[model samples]
Target: MISRLPGLSLPERVWNTARRWAVAWWRILYLGAVVLVLVLSPSSYGKGTRRALARHLYLDTAPVLLGFTVLAALISLVLTRIVVVTALSYGLSRYALEMVIRVLVLELIPLTAALFVAMRCTIPNGAQLSRLRQAGRFDALRSQGSDPVRIELLPRVIAGVFACVTLAALSCVVALVLAYLGVYGFNMAGLSGYTRMFGQVFSPSVTMVFVLKTLFFSLAVALIPMAAGLYDSGERAQPDSELGGLARMFAVLLLIETASLMGNYY
Candidate 1:
């Protein structure tokens, strides 16, 4: 029962691909609405649900993020030393602190945190959720009058967003401190000039954009994988959907980084 119309087959394939992307985007939008509701509804932060999620997010993820924090600190310290030495070598030592704050704090930490949550938590958890669906646990939950998206998936999504925001903020603070130490050592002699430079770099407009960028990064980290899981419209679970989700997420992340660069530099 196969009809091989070659010319029509080509057009059909093209339309199919287009339709697939369309469906994927629609699913993403729907998930965005769900997340918005969760954000606006105070019930989301109720005692039992948020406690379990936050406890899991904080306690369980703390060890991983602690290790990650040390790693990021080391990397930031190395990069700070390099930027400082290079600036001093070029007689641009005065600009080094500004560079450190802009590059490491505003740019690197947020993107790195998003990627860490994506790779470590989101994708793997999504794949596992897919497996659960494939194993008929989805129906099992439904049989108990439990909606998986609201009860189960939302927590993971919220947790991922929380993880991204938490890690990014914490890492940026650590990097800022390390940058100061790298450029000025333990003494506070250079503190006044450093504070002036920080003020110049983090003006109100720049701060607003930074907050917006971080918010977008958090949404992207949280939404993509879970939405990908929702949109796995195949007969069984597969990696193809997860891989496509990652590609899409990173594309958005890159765009965010590029926009931040333009905002900061241009």
Candidate 2:
């Protein structure tokens, strides 16, 4: 009788699974690095590339920004009211404004904006990319002396970044204004106090952490889906791939938020 190969032990199986995960993650990072290099290259900003980028940016940003702004404003208003009322009840009114800024502006808005972009734009774009890959469009473009990534994918990634940053910024501004109104009730007398309070809340270190966290959130929203699509082999349908991308993106966002919270509070 022919000899049979032995089955893997539990440790060997676990090791194999971990190694596969590591290799997959390394490939994703490699793809991100390549995109970053192309983005920074002077030649990547050709006339055609600029036009494509502009189109993608506009499409990704304009339609969703207005809706998200309205929603964010409503949520901010309600949350601000709740916080202000609770602070008054607890005789902690003095700390209400700082709490609002830290919780809503620094934490919630950026995270929400990233998730909004991922749901509205990047996930769908990734699915489309996977479909194109399934149809071998990438290889066809390569055979035509064209770079599919630069021409087709980079713009979506850049636009996703723009959408996340812009949405978060606009929402934060709205939240700050609403917070002031909720706390001080549209009195011009509170303007100086509001400005001072804002400055106090956003110390240099806190500001740095906020900015870095927002940028990382934007990148996670944009890049994870793109990476998933780039590596998807079409063994699964588009919806399944999108679901996996969403899970991965959520995990990364959670990690980023956890780190930001530690940096800010600890």
Query: Whole-model lDDT, candidate 1?
Result: 0.79
Query: Looking at model 2, which ten-residue stretch has the lowest summed lDDT?
Result: 232-241
**Counting only residues 3 or more apart in sequence or on different chains, how many pairs clash (N, Cα, C under 3 Å) in candidate 2?**
0
Off by over 4 Å in 2: 1-16, 233-240
> What TM-score against the true fold does each predicted structure earn?
0.89, 0.91
For candidate 1, what is the TM-score? 0.89
Model 1 bad stretches (over 4 Å): 1-8, 43-48, 234-240
Residue pairs in candidate 2 whose N, alpha carbon or C atoms collide under 3 angstroms = none
What's the lDDT for candidate 2?
Answer: 0.85
lDDT of 1 by residue, 54-142 (tens): 76587426756797799789988999988888998999988888887888888888888888888888777677677777788878879
